[model samples]
Target: MGLIAGIYSIENKAIDSGRHLDKMIQCQQHRCQGGEPVKYINKQIAIAMVNPLDSIFSEYDIPTNSHNPISGLYNGIYAFTDGIVLDVPKHKIYFESNGLPMQDNTCSSIVAAAYQKWGLDFMLHLEGEFSCAIWDEKKKRLVLARDPFGHKPIHYYSNNKKVYFSSEIKGILDAGVNPGIDLTSLSDFLSLNCIPYPATIFKNIFQVPPGSLVIINSLDIKIKKYWEPVISVDKTISFENAAQMITESLKEAVKRRMMAKDAFCFLSGGMDSSAIVSFMTEVSSSTVHAVSVGFEEEEENELEDAAVMAKHVGAKLHQVIAKPDSFFDMLDLMVFHHDTPFTDTSAYPTFYAGKLGSSLTDVILTGDGPDQTMGGSGHYVFAVKNNIFANRKKTFQFLSGIGAGIASALSIDPTPALFSKIHRKLYRQSLGPVHAAYDIRSYFPDIVKKYLCTKNLYDVHSAHNPYRHPEAWFKQAQGLDDINKYLYADMQFYVPDDLMIKVDRMCMAHGLETLSPFQDIKLAEIVNKLPGHYKILQTKNNQIITKYILQKVCENRFPEQILTKKKQGFGVPLEKWLKQNNGEKIKEILLDPGSLQRGYFKGKSIEKFVNVFLENKGDYFFPGPNAIAGLLTLELWHRRYLDFI
Candidate 1:
């Protein structure tokens, strides 16, 4: 793994690109701890990278083939890769079949050779999680590409004159791009709990969407999608056959990721992580090292289950307890690492899990992708059921109105203290299946956001629909079944933006490289095409099973308890923890004179909201612990990155 950053001057301005590149690299030194730093500079472009000691390519300089300098023959071609490229033997074979000469077996050389042969299409042939930056000196064009599933992240900022790109947002910030809040993106975050792709918290900075490339030239910058998930169902494939294929594919994925002699697996005792541990043991001759994190709260603790899974798999288990004592300290670090207003409470446990894993090994494996790809989330089941009711929208709306009228006539209040609960439910029921499904994942709806924010901030984003970003993806999944549509939208937006960002940043902060077997592009190509019912199965007895196919794959290998166990998601007890001393600290920061003067939120509304939640006087419809966490993180981010400056 490595960190890459660079600057491309469209006007070829007299600027010191190398100096900016140096600061970018220096800011993200944690990513390249004990690694080699390399840079290439010219009049129009400057490229810099830091490859970890264990990276596949030790040298990232320009291609050295004199006989066939590839594109360098025209002028000079430079390429830098961050993250792994799996299936090296197959890549070499493909290169040989295509009659492409390679200077060496390293990944950098392979990329250069492939670019020479296929030009821009070279990324389509690579099967791994990576972000690569290629500069064409001849054309004076700069290209940045990310892997299909976006396992690696690339954040870039561009003005009309120059473009700056990096593996992390902090890199670009250090490269002289002043940071400013994007209110629309902040609304997106407040509504959806995450800022979607192509839109980051910083006004001008954006992420290179997964399976896409950003091409910057002297004229303009353009983005092109190189790959995407295709949902062409094969109706003839039987359940047994599909399960077998998934099992084999997952095993192969695990085997491919076990390239390092010392690698550990994050075992959460959930099906995803448990399945990964099971496969890791089967692929490695040595005993697998498993890591887990739990909180003091019993409901949030999964260490016992993780230990049980580890023992069953014959792996050594390492466990860590996440405490409230270090909560604020950890939050400060998390906000710094995330580089945005992130509200994934699970990131707390993930951060500690990565820290524990990094203490043991550099490379760590996780079970991250299957939930979106294979329909593992319980929310999918709810979406399917909700869609059934949502189809009878006319009847539902009539009944809801009649019920409300009858309650009013009888002077009965269903939600006396929380009237918004009834309104929210009725509003959601009025939406179609796709919108309803989207609402299921949203923390705060747009209407509530209006009340939460100041008029200035609210009015600026009022014209923009919070659901606009996700709706576009849902529209793309038009003809698919309801479940598939939800899965497709989630795969396109949620996984890459929220889940992947959480895992990638938390782990990378400690210099740990994480690999997700379920994120295998090959596996997704096969699984994504399967019918939705195969993933969320309905039995004759009226029982719904989520991730049915995956359970079937693990039926014999995993213990019966493990296979039948309900999915306890990687969640932390935010409510319980927020009531602790840290809660008071959060209140102090969020309600501080400086914080209130920011004018992003209504002071009175926020004070009342925080007081109600912290005092446990809020009703069911009130903003929960997650929303409070969002506010705290946003304020902390401002202090750490923006306010500090």
Candidate 2:
């Protein structure tokens, strides 16, 4: 709904905190279109925010609570919020229970009151997509917290003398934090197509991890996690009961997110989005609007399915067609909005969908979280099957090692074909269940990336292994089954880093606000405790079904075609587009002298790789269209964020 930024001088430096805040807000003007910036400043700190025109409190006549980025001063605590608090009534009840009645029901007032009573533990009682900054005036202490699933983003930079935080990276950069590309994060992007949390492309700026708080004072800065997905199976809960609980939880979640006068949904015709639309119709008094995007390629288009779902739900559907010609025009803008190198090709269609939806309403609902939380992704099935195979570790490793040795003895030269056929088998067999699942999700395997990058770039990042991030997450799910372990890691790393970032940046580029009902903390608390088999059901005939419980909930309510249709994920025809004339432009930019001069990749290796992909001659070793897109976006990001700045 808005953006927040601020600076704190640890040494109490005599700087103009208000002027610096003005510069930071100016950098994020796109996110605050139609609203003025608000600021609270002192000698040691400055906090500022800008709410959108359609903010939740816009209709209120109260002087202090008329808009978001609302602030409150109570009991020596000052608080500011960028998004809504869904459960304000719950907080009010708690305050009354403690014999400390609230004077106002505004989000900032509630937050300030709660912090005054419970201190930092107050974050555990808040429920919504928000990022808040609270300053303890008496203690000279500042605390920043993000919502559980990171629906709102917060980035910060700290040093011995000063600390800076913002809702977006550009704000911090504009506040005079010199931007230097973090090579380790560059390696992460090349491997995962997105950088993991707490580390951004910029070395100095870092994100505050989701479901966590960052406390900075004159002494030190500390981060603490207040929430995480817990795995605890309920043995007595029947499948029917679980499905019923999911149905109710989903409806409640949708109802809570319906805070705006006019809200629409991003319907991909997939079960998740369709379910959201169905629930929206059930809960809303007004007609629901659904937005969908399709591609020129027949195989990639889902307009027909989307129309079918829209008719079934009795909602008006708005559709947009994404063409290759407009790809180049939106490329730089996308990169700039992301503030980093993000190459999820689906972002193209997502951007167009948001643009269409923004014309109708500022708030948009999406079906984003279930794939990771409810095991709806196809990769879950792949992980389960691979885990089963990997369970027989000794036998599989022995056989695969012999096969690799035989291929070596035959002088296969480890060519792309042979490596794809032989070495990958060895690689998979040698890894544990968690590692195997991670490998299956990687955009580029570590060995393949080594051949692609220059020795210097590769070696500089050698000590900073990107896989460590996922491995750490995997370790947290230690007691769970392999499937749950993989899912937990995805929830912790991939969902917030890649999927959420793509949706948030693409939609917010046009000043749109998005909410995901499936990401509800209560819903996840129920779903995460279910056994792995409940999520990925296996039939007597050995057939695999992903999200079985969700399907059961939708069995009678949704059409059979929608319930049974294979999940064609929200993606674009990047391969097809990359083969067109635009591919030549990509090739030229990647191989241009300016690009090669950066020294990220060896000139000869990159030249051959780009040629191989454009000529339709790619192999396992050669880069594919997705990898090429990553490289192209990286170059574009450099030109805009690094080069221009």
Candidate 3:
């Protein structure tokens, strides 16, 4: 998808600083690294873009007749879109979108169609992973919109003098305003692994949140939500039908995604990836190459299972045996691309995977969204089971008995330490799922949070924390069950900001396009409306399963043993990395005099974190390796993007 940046200044303070807009665009050129796309500006309002059409073709091929940069027309109403529009020809109207020229629609077409038919109601028919900009000539108004799931992102900054918008934050910073770090967001980023919408790491610059749109003119500015995930717990379909529907819908989604001439699949050896590969192979006319990454340890790698699936699908398998130093070498580039403190250590593996996949093809499909969308997370399993007990401490103590039994039977750790960990895991959930996810998964512990932030840690969160009250997400879906409360909260932030952010940055770094079949709108609607329990189902034999329908999709294709495998995130050996000789680079960067001089985090607290990290004790200060990685990642990000300040 192409990137867009613009400046809209009121007539009284009008300025034609096209050079600044160009600089803004230059910062985000990596989003679509290949070709130069046209830009249009009028009456002090400017728009810059990398066309979505190049998402398919490396060359510029637009229909001659449909729409061109005809002089006066471009001046009045300018439009740009960052993702594909499927039904451009469905309306025969003059529309342009990100995809290759056909009947495909564009951000301009949608604006034109909306005025032609539904007036302001056009968003009801809008569908795609897109962020769009439209400037109105007659009204002197500008509009911005993002897709429901925010698959494509839109960010903007508004001051009394001007309003600036872009697909990334660098564009806003490029306007010569350089709003420094938003400390609140910096705190949240260290804790949540991302900064949520409307608040970027920088103040003033803001995200036009998902499912929302913004309109601006000389007199006023307005933003409204046009659509959201319709979470309904009402279901009439049988389990068999539900499973079949998920399988069929996903297959069709994957088929539609396979529109490219030479698309490949990212096979992680998990059920989601395996099922996607199976469907891709079923639909493709040629052999599909699947790419995967594995680590040195058996516990940290899944290459064996990946090999099994590659053979099952009769596809060529490309495996990268990853090590700590190789990942560390790319650390600075990773930090720059992320544009924020992205501490998901797995991003290292994804970065390498994308780099590897780019050599084979420009288009690849990934297995994302299943865990957050369908409740396939191991944490969810533990949370659901944990919520069952009134006295969680005692209940978990009992569960510890089961864990103890399993450990003893398997000749594993049956120590008191194991029991204590089992206790904390359950105790965290007893508070809430999102809370536990945040608190338990947080890199910086409360003790460390004190010094981790320059401001008082609690004072840093003067406003309510969304993690503590996940129920807020379910207010719209009042009939939604507990399982969905977590799902809805995660869908809103974690999946999009964290997982999807990683996918977007890593893939674009290599100039490749990634499609996820599981994130299909139709498929999401079918599953979201169903009872949340369907996400984690139980068989007659008392077997509990997460992503039940997804597991069913690849049952025949994946082996029986594969079904029992626990959920595994991309395997980045974080502890091993931090302990490596090269790993000392992380400590050097994090503990740099410039890093401490920022005075954002306390020196004493970081020193302690560094001590534990260097010793390689790795007991998970808050959650262990993530703490060290996150701190280092943030320091690197500051050094890369914000150090100039």
Candidate 4:
């Protein structure tokens, strides 16, 4: 919700550089705490705090009645232990908060508390969402930290004399930092559609990972992770008891998120969203407001399903129809809004859905984490197979589980070709421990494989690490018969990076506060430990399905047709749209001389992909259109950031 920037000079005084920092602050001033900038300058020290949205205050809440007297502070940085400045000297250490606190502590409180408790390690305890920095006046050092989920961005640039940092990548680049793309990261984007942790588009510039802090003194830089997501157990509970427990926790999760002056919920007619909205309606006296997006009548529509739920819950629903015209218009806007190459075509409709919610409420609540937590993906079966294979000591049961899994995975009459592809690919890729290493390595683009990973990021991805290990990912899955490793990977990577990023940017762009009930600290823990059967149950037709408990919850409220519907997530029809007007523009940027000239991709290979896309009857929106869209989006972003043409 905000941007923070600071500079620490190693040799000379930071006088002129501090003034330069002010100009840098102006560029992201829109992100300042409601557009306010706090500049503290001393002889050798300079600090600047900029918040783009509302700051967090524990004692104060937005008056629900709208008639109560205002509290102590509206929007201001409360300094707990003020740092000293010498003779109007520039202060390079600055901290600011707008959306949510990373930890329960205030910026000054955490800094002061950290200095008090563990000396410099106090940062380990703080939680919430924040981007903060500190300038060491005497030693001429700069320190920065970002919240664990990376909802906030912290970009920094350091040379010989001064170190400049900010919450936006563009802001730091604007501060005279090199904006050139990191040659090593090109493959990272092509493979994963995002720069991996601790890396960014720019070479010298890097993003501080979530739950991490960075310190720089005279170019001696250090980055450390202070937090990670972990699943805890409540071993005493039975399956039925756990289901009841989850329901209760989910109720409270919905309740806490209702803490808004005026709130809206995204209702996608899917199990996850419908469950949240249903809970919200039951808890609130007034009807909850709901927003949804559907493609123009013909292609894939969810309006009827959304309407059914809305009627049952007595909520007022606003639906946005993604007519062909609207799809292209939104596509253009999404390219700019994302500011990067994102392959998730669903991002466009998701953006529109958020925009729709923004106009109606000051805050919007979403159901995002459930699918990941509950084993909702198609790949969960393979993970379960691998788990059974690993655990089976007896030949009979082990062989039986493997046969069942392979049969379940290979059953062609019922399952989609995509499901088959995912299952075969996972099993093929995970044939032995070595292929797991190869799978990890193949996840990156060839360009990155060749140039960037000299240290072998794949090899570094731990065998025991849940983030990379196929078995660990399998164990994390909640499905009954099949384990969804793709769901596991999606939760760890996609949920935070693409979905959460989309929500944060779209909502904050208009100053609307958005919260995710599924992100509740406790509910996530419970879901993480639930038995896979309750998470994913076998359908009568034998396809894997999600949220058996949730399905039962809505059984009386909605029909089977609605609950069993295919998951057509809020996404754009990018492939279909690209074939229309200015489609070639996307192709041009993707295959631009720049991507080739810069050696990010092989020009011939890029052309071949485009040719296949144009010729084949493939899933255009998934890979074909997505690759072109992402590449073009990045090219447009480069123009916006660099050429400004």
Which candidate wins on lDDT? 2
CA displacement after TM-score superposition, residue 448 of candidate 2 (Å): 1.6
Candidate 1 TM-score, C-alpha based: 0.93
**Counted clashes in each candidate structure:** 0, 0, 9, 34
Residue lDDT tens for model 1, 384-477: 6545423655787677766544443443222225445555666665555555555666666554566678888787666887777767887798
Summing lDDT over every window of 10 consecutive residues in candidate 3, give the lowest-scoring window: 95-104
Q: Model 4: per-residue lDDT, tens digit, 336-444?
A: 5555555667776676676677678655777777666676544454444444334333455445446545744454421125554454344433344323332433333
lDDT scores of the candidates, listed in order? 0.79, 0.80, 0.70, 0.56
Report lDDT (Cα) of residue 442, candidate 4. Answer: 39
Ranking by lDDT: 2, 1, 3, 4
lDDT of 3 by residue, 1-645 (tens): 467788888553656667988888888877765657567666568776775452242134554233432134233455667765444444334333432223323445544445434544556676555677877676777889877777777788877788888887777777777777777787677666677776778787788877887888888888888877777765787777888888889888887777567769898888889888888888888998999988887788989888898898888899987776566657778877777777777888888788898788767888888899888876677666656313345565566556644544443221124553554444444453345555655665333465456665447654545353344564554556767876887888787778877887777777666777888888988888767778887557756689877776677877765667877878576776777884568667877788877777777666656765576543654337777777777788777677676
User: If scored against the real structure, what TM-score would every candidate get?
Assistant: 0.93, 0.94, 0.86, 0.73
**lDDT at 273, model 4:** 84
The TM-score that candidate 4 achieves is 0.73
| Winner by lDDT between candidate 4 and candidate 3 | 3
Error of 1 at 21 (Å): 0.9
Cα error of candidate 2 at position 449, Å: 0.3
